[model samples]
Target: MRIIDAHQHFWDLEANYLPWLTDKPVNFRYGDYDAIKKSYLPADYRQDAQEFELAASVFIETEWDPTDPLGEVAWVNSLRKRESLPSVMVAQAWLDRDDAESVLAAHGQTDFVRGIRHKPKAASAPGDVVPGAPGSMGDPAFRRGFSMLAANGLSFDLQTPWWHLPEAADLAEAYPNTQIIINHTGLPADRSDDGLAGWRAALMRAAECPNISIKISGLGQKGKPWESAENRPIIRDTIEIFGADRCMFASNFPVDSLVGTFSTIFNGFRDAVEDFTPGEQQALFHDNAARIYRIDPTREV
Candidate 1:
């Protein structure tokens, strides 16, 4: 089936923003010495996606240094100039900034920018989710940024820790006009903790919003196992709650690859919904991303 992965990331240590990679697992180092480097240009993602026959993709920002939003946009866009990148970039710029328009304008200079995401769940320090943080989805500054996106016809690629789903959903409740796409199905876990049950319901309600879409990527990549067939039901529950039209597939790549292969991550998705309709499968793999991000997979990279 034709596919459009709505999420992917690329960073080079040569860039000022990439010092963050040293903190990442060795698998994610893009170009650091004494670390495994990632060849994360469009060619790399394009090659890995070849087996799945993806038509296009949306790129989300992995680095979130809010200190320099415009600089970050220019930096990521610069990568596209250096090589033919396949996906549109979702910059993690200051949606909450008073200058949200200018920040987006910087990204708009490029053909690849599709959206923005500054995950609230991120700990100020790495390796854990921070509770009660102001993620880009709901901050007043983010409020203005989201408006900038809607005005520019861009989507918001949202990633939050498991705790903030209800608040994120509450934000969705407030701004019905925003084209919100939930990252990692709001990141449900195999073993529930931290008010996960309530988070699931919040996500379900947000899915009911016609404007919202969900990226069914990044979950297993966060490191979980199905153990047996019993764990398969979570995917079903997501589909039933969000509906296939509102769901799309993504690799979240090297990050998710930390836990599973690209083929295994995707095949696991196929396994999750083997019983669903081919059309549902189509939406999950490609159509939803194309529709939500407004990129043609058939376009030349």
Candidate 2:
């Protein structure tokens, strides 16, 4: 089947500063990382996805240096020229920063840019890597940055943990005109039954807002079991909650490479959703992403 990977990334180690991917002493959600620390480019992705018919992919921001956020978009735009697979680009902007509107405007100038992702994971308890104070999304400056998205004709990608979905829902409710996509199937980091229950409940809450959609990717976090059998339940549940129209599958690429290969992650999604109708399968793998990202699905890869 032809598939459009809804979320993935490419990074040049020499050209960009990706401290999180390389910096030692990092407490990544998944424990050890030495496996996939090298540069991951489009060619590498093509090789990893060799077993499947990869129609297109969406290149998401890699959270590069905040000072020159547009640099990441420019660099990825160059890649998009050389490789047609990443037909869409979702750049980053520090929404809390004062100069966010200017940066967003610059990003808007790039034709491939469809949305912006500012990491909003709040630090609620101790030992959280990216903890934010309570109600950080409600801050005046942050909301101000968010308000500018509609004017720029861009969408928003929210990446907070499952617990923060309700807060994200608040923002979605406030700005119905803005399309908010929840990344990583709500990032269900905790695979335990109790943890999964929390994730499910929060996902339902976030889905209540019709404008909010969910990206069912990035399920291969650290320490999680890496197999289709393990992912089947949650994958099915996610599709059930958001329904086929609102849910799309993504590879999450190099980040998920640590858990399994591209074929493995994507094939697992296929297996999980095999019972759905052919149109539903099309929606999960390609149609939904094309519509949401405004990409011409017929574009040559």
Candidate 3:
């Protein structure tokens, strides 16, 4: 089947300054990301995704140097000029920062940029959530910067945990014109029964906002390999909650590669939705991303 990978990344560690990959390792959820610290440009990604019918991919920001947000967009634009695989990008921007407007304007000037990703301040656990905290999604200053997206014709790529989905829902409600694409199924790393129950309820709340959509990627467990049995239920539930039109499939490649091969994740998604009609499957794999990200699948860029 044809595909538009909704969320993936490419980084040149030697040429670019990705502090997370270069500096002393931070407490990464995937644990010890040293394996992927090396450059993963278009060629490397193509090799890993060679078996799949990948029509195009969206390059989400790889936490490039925070001081130079536009620098990352420029580098991705350069890559697109030569490689043409990442048809579009979700560039990095800190919504709560002082330079947010100027940075967002710079990104808007780039033709290939479709959206912005700023992982809002999240509570460590569900109970710790404090609404309207500074830098959190509800922060007045953050929302002030977020309000700028609609005028720029850019969407928001949110990567907060599921516990924060209520805040996400409120943000979506407040900014109905600005599309909010939830990354990684709201980062549902907890798979226990109560955990999933909370996740499902939170997802349902986010889905109620018509402007919100979700990418079903980054389902990797800390120690376990990416398996359909472990993720199929979550995948199916996400699609059910958001519906095929609002949901899309993604590799979350290189990062998810820590858990399994490209085929393992994509194939598992395909298998999980095998019983759905071809149209629904098409939306999940290809259509939703193309429409949501404003990608021209036929253009080959």
How many clashes in each structure? 6, 4, 0
Candidate 3 lDDT tens digits, 159-259? 99999999999999999999999999989888889999999999999999999999999999887899999999999999889998999999998899999
lDDT of prediction 1: 0.65
Error of 1 at 290 (Å): 0.5
Candidate 3: C-alpha lDDT: 0.92
Write one digit per residue (lDDT tens) for candidate 1, span 121-235. 3532223444334653455665666666666656677776545555667677677777788887676653455445655776776776777778777665233442225335556
Each prediction's Cα lDDT score? 0.65, 0.84, 0.92
Instruction: Say which prediction, candidate 1 or candidate 2, comes out ahead on TM-score.
Output: 2
Per-candidate alpha-carbon RMSD to the true structure = 4.6, 2.4, 0.9
What TM-score do all the candidates reach, one by one? 0.80, 0.94, 0.98
Residue 221 CA displacement from its true place in model 1, Å: 6.4
List clashing residue pairs in candidate 3.
Answer: none
TM-score, candidate number 3: 0.98
Give me the candidate number with maximum TM-score: 3
Most lDDT-accurate candidate: 3
